[model samples]
Target: MVQNSTDPVGWEHFDHDADVGVRGIGVTQAQAFEQAALALTSIVTQIESVEPRQRIDISAENGDPELLFVDWLDALIFEMATRRMLFSRYKVDIEGERLSARAWGEPVDVNRHQPAVEIKGATLTELKVEEQDEGQWLAQCVVDV
Candidate 1:
């Protein structure tokens, strides 16, 4: 998908065997996490189709950014599975190793959402989080389906 200059935060899928790979890019680490969550949501359905009717709070902490990304995504997966919801909007804040975030989405509508697959959890395989020379942050990992 094409990312607009006005909104530097975006997510994409990379080829992976059996599972799917998700990558998020943004100007800040928080934005990258938010975008990565979006990527995870997109794996199941078109994110734009999900309504922001309900709000969910999520948080995670890890000494390393890569592990933090995995924790963040895993928390989201737990919420989505338990709530039977799909999140399209996210706002994240990171202070040191702790991350606080809010995700907004409604319960799944099978007819409208047309979800493709059930995402089990985020995995450490191919995981990475880093800042580029141009100052943008990237967070990525493969998720089990």
Candidate 2:
């Protein structure tokens, strides 16, 4: 089943049993975090209309990509909650497992970007990063909307 049409960030049931869990996938860890952030944005406002002008860099250890991914999203959330900043587009660099990502977007404008819901947090549920034999990383994440 679906949750709400108002949410801009797309989300689907994790399984047939309960609707508590949802999943989002991307081509890389950075993309995955970007998608997850979009999901949160969709919940808050119309993501399609969110202008992608703000830019910043996010880098962390290579030991745990998952933890880094969470930190990445948290940074975005903090930007919004504290400074009311929102971001679009994620450029991530991963060597072995270390991550250095850059996000591009602009500050949140209540009149312009009508956020639908507040993103409480992004979790580690069903977190995964793998390859499709082509060598490109595929990152999957489930964030709490």
Candidate 3:
């Protein structure tokens, strides 16, 4: 069963016992990755609540798509932790094994943002990057929160 939906480019949360499963679906692989990042932010607070007051540029490279996906999300997690921010908007461009992304969000406001939990990192467990027969793409993994 699906939990959350955001249409066109959207994310969903799946059950994972102690952890949460974040999945992104889109018409393209890059879009899927972008959506997955949304799922990551959603873990803490409502994505709609985040104001795009800041923009951060992040890039990651890997030889495999699955590993690349993990690296991409990990980079975002690092930025969030270090910058003390929550990202809501993301634009990802993937070429071969290289990924260039720009995330937009503002500093975390405890009262306004009301973040629920801190996301520790993205794990490789249940990691997948696959294209559907209908031409859409899916990116998912169990995030360590």
Highest lDDT: give the candidate number.
1
Score candidate 3 by lDDT.
0.90
Give the Cα-based TM-score of candidate 3 against the true structure. Answer: 0.94
lDDT of 2: 0.59
Over 96-131, each residue of candidate 1 has an lDDT whose tens digit, in order, gives 999999999999999999999989999999999998
Worst 10 residues of 2 by lDDT: 15-24
Q: Write the per-residue lDDT of candidate 3 for residues 97-137, one digit (tens) a residue.
A: 89999999999999998999998888989999999746579
Candidate order, lDDT descending: 1, 3, 2
Clashing pairs in 3: none
CA shift of 55, model 3, Å: 0.6
Candidate 2 on 41-81: residue-level lDDT in tens?
Answer: 55566665767776777766747766776666666667667
Which candidate's TM-score is highest? 1
How would you order the candidates by TM-score, starting with the best? 1, 3, 2
Candidate 1 residue-wise lDDT at 54: 91
RMSD of 1: 1.6
Model 2 residue 143 CA deviation (Å) reads 2.0
Candidate 3 stretches with Cα past 4 Å from truth are 1-8
What shift in Å separates residue 45 of candidate 1 from its native position after superposition?
0.5
